[model samples]
Target: MVKTIITLLMMIILFLGGTLFGIDQASEGIIQTRGYATADVKEAVQPSRDEAGNVEVELLGKDLQQVTFEEKEQEFQEIESSNFTQKLAGSMEKGVSSFYNLMIQSVYQLVQVFF
Candidate 1:
């Protein structure tokens, strides 16, 4: 019947569309993947106050810290107890989360065809 044909067509179209465009569903959700991701870096100027009472921002034009990842998953409590890399990563988490949220939202809006 026409209904069955339409259903089959939709299924085929969605399957093809998913293969071409819906990698997000095929992969883990954005939030979950974000947990495994390393933080993005931006060159920035951070203020440093000298002993002689001069305060000025120094430009750090390089990636301030490189991510030295160990395969072990770092936990909140462990970050405080562990070495420099863990602490630095914990500190960067907030900014990275915000950045990811903004980027994903923007892309979602741009790609949304249902509206």
Candidate 2:
């Protein structure tokens, strides 16, 4: 039948197309294979600070502490307590904060685009 002949021709065309595509990809991969090469990397040039003086800004509440070493160690231990409740609470807070920040950013961008 004509239908059968058409189907067979279509199948043959598809098969040939796929074969040619695969062969092309294989040839490209082979051609791209590197046998050997030596590369010399130059050292990075440092920027001159004299050209532009650095400006450091510290956050409002983050001041240098005058606490003793023992007090600092105690505070660190309190912070680093590996309790299940603390870990879960901290993770949840971070996740919520991240989602809130993303939502604010998305709204800001959408507003900017519209306005």
Give lDDT tens digits, candidate 1, residues 1-115: 9999999999999999888676856455664765643255343667666677666565765323322255334555476576888668877998899999999999899889656
Off by over 4 Å in 1: 1-82
Q: Which stretches of candidate 2 lie over 4 Å from their true place?
A: 1-82
TM-score of 2: 0.30
Residue-pair clashes per candidate, as listed? Answer: 0, 0
86-113: candidate 2 lDDT, tens digit per residue: 7899999999999999999999999999
In model 1, state the lDDT of residue 108.
94
- Reference-based lDDT, each prediction: 0.69, 0.72
Q: Model 2 misses residue 82 by how many Å?
A: 6.1
Error of 2 at 32 (Å): 94
Could you say which candidate leads in TM-score?
2
TM-score of each: 0.23, 0.30
lDDT at residue 67 of model 2 (Cα atoms) = 49
Weakest 10 consecutive residues of candidate 1 by summed lDDT: 62-71
- Global lDDT for candidate 1? 0.69
